[model samples]
Target: MKLTDDHLQTFVEQGFVIVEDFYPEERRAQIAEGIRQTLPPWEVIADDPPARRLLTDDFPYADMLFNEFILDWDLIAFVQRVLDTEDIFFRYAHNWARYPDPGAEQPGLHIDNGNNSLLPPTSDRRYGQISTWYFPEAVDENQAPMQIVPKPYGQDLSKRVLLTVPAGTIMIFNTHLWHSATVFKGREGQRYSATRIYGRAD
Candidate 1:
């Protein structure tokens, strides 16, 4: 679906947008599979809980190790649309895989840097690199889904917190926002999500 001005406003004010089915289901499967192939068996799934990993590791530990999702024309089209640009490049990305497991607690609300415990930002910074995650599985509310605190430090931020829609839903959020995935029951199920970064052309 094309992004409307309202969508952009929501993102700027709330820090994220959950666009339903941004990609066709068939294509989403391919992207998900590509990410699955590169994962270690140990990191694959957890019936008791799920698994989480940052592909940015030095030695390297991402599922696909590349933008497999970018290759899909339809998917890229949507990405371009959301970005409101005629052209875009597929830069860096990360992946997350949550399996249907017991004792799964949703991820806590934290910014990207905060989630990873990166160096604190300077006071003048209003935004950071934008990141997007396309979840390919079905996510129900009870799953804890992904909760976000809109524009963490933005003027519009109300301290009003909210949860993102489940799997197969795509979310584009400002890195400055505090967000996290709340793990819930899905022991036998798998939640696969990937992020793609976009930037201006040189």
Candidate 2:
């Protein structure tokens, strides 16, 4: 779906926006299945403490489904508008699955750039990077939905957005936004999501 001006404004003001039904249900299912089948071969990156698994490294580039999804024209156009540049390039991609770990602590909210940030958060122009997260299945609060402070980094947490979206929903956010993932408390299954990072080609 094409992004409206309001959507762009929201991203600028709130530092993030969710686009529902970004992918069709059948297509989401196919992507979900592909992730499930493909993730098994990768070694568990962190299983002892948090039950984290990564389908990253060489896998994202090598996997046909992931490669296609990253280069989708619509997605690229959206990112281009946000960054105000046509010179966009894929930075990284990862499929993460986290199981319920009651004792595990939820991560603190923080911006993605950290020590590598080139510009301050108050800047009007976009810099650094942006990311898109795709949820193949519907996600509720129990499934560890991402919590984003509505304001830019270092601002007071006056408002927050908890992303409880339907299957095929994609959330795109500025890397400078303060955000963190809620702990998984659901009993049913793992919280599955695929993430792709993009930046100016230069």
Candidate 3:
């Protein structure tokens, strides 16, 4: 679906926006199943207080369902509009599943473009890349939600946006924005999300 004016303004002001119901229920279910099939077995970290499992570097390129979702015309259009460029290319993609862990320390707030940033951290929105986090399953506050500081980079966390969205939601944010993931504390099941990064095609 196309972005509304409010959605665009939110992204410009807060550095991120969530597109609700971006994917249909059937498509979301298919993607979730494809990921479950493609991912390697879970490897839990023993030393961690709450058991944590991580799966990385395995993208389901062969999955036609995932391919269709990623190349969605509306998604591409949104990225192009945000970057103010017609040429946009995929930079990276990955999926993560966080199992429930009591007192587990989620990743600290950080910018994705730090150190590897192509433009100065203070550059305008068009200079940096956009990253998307897609949830194939419904996500709640206790299920390792993403926390984003709404202010510009380096600002204090007076205001924050916690991503507690339904299944098939897509959250897009500027690479330079400060954000972090929370620990999973739900009663059942792990938190699953697939993310893809895109940059201006130079």
Candidate 4:
């Protein structure tokens, strides 16, 4: 979906914007099912080193389901507008399953710039990278919503924005934004999300 003036302003001020109702429930389910089919059981991955390595080292784009979802024209156009560039390239894709862990604590907030680029962020955001996470499952407060600190807020924990949205929500954020994953407090099902990263060609 195209970003409106308000959405663009939010991204400019907060460094991130959540786009919802863009992908239909059916399409989201299809892409999610593909990921779940390939994903090994969490227990199996924990116990098997080879299984874990294979998953961590592999990219999900090999599957056409994921490819179509991430390569959709509308999504790319939206990203291009945000980066203000027609030259953009796909960086990577990964799927994550967040399950309930009894004593696990939320990790520290950090920018994606560390692994995405060597140079620091620019004032013009010309070299900025985009990290888009498509959530197939509706996220609730207790279901481990992503915590993001607005660009102007620095590392203040109290100023964090919790992303609690419906299914089929795609959140696009600049890589320089500080964010962290909170622990899953729900006792039942796990939360599923897939991320696709993109960077400017120049």
lDDT of 3 by residue, 53-149 (tens): 5555344567666655567677778888888999988777777777666567767888887544566665588877888899888888888888888
Error of 3 at 99 (Å): 1.0
Quick one: best lDDT, which candidate? 4
lDDT scores of the candidates, listed in order: 0.55, 0.73, 0.75, 0.75
Worst 10 residues of 3 by lDDT: 40-49
Per-residue alpha-carbon lDDT of candidate 2 for residues 1-202, written as tens digits (9 for 90 to 100): 7778888899887778899988777888898887767554223433443334223333345668887778778778878888889998787787877656545577788887754345566455457578889888778888778888865544454567888888888898887778888887765455678888887775
TM-score of each: 0.63, 0.83, 0.84, 0.86
- lDDT comparison, 1 vs 3, better candidate: 3
Candidate 4: where are CA atoms >4 Å away? Answer: 40-62
Candidate 4 Cα RMSD after full superposition onto the native fold (Å): 3.2
Candidate 4: what lDDT? 0.75
Where does candidate 2 have its weakest 10-residue lDDT segment? Answer: 49-58
Which pairs of residues have clashing backbones in candidate 3? none
The parts of candidate 1 lying over 4 Å away from their true place are 36-68, 71-91, 104-107, 114-126, 142-144, 152-167, 199-202
lDDT of 1 by residue, 84-195 (tens): 5656565566665554444644455555664432436432223244567777666665444666666555433356454445446788765656666665464344455666
* Ranked by lDDT, top first: 4, 3, 2, 1
lDDT for position 149 in model 4: 88
* Model 2 regions more than 4 Å off: 40-62, 114-122, 152-155
Clashes of each: 14, 0, 0, 0
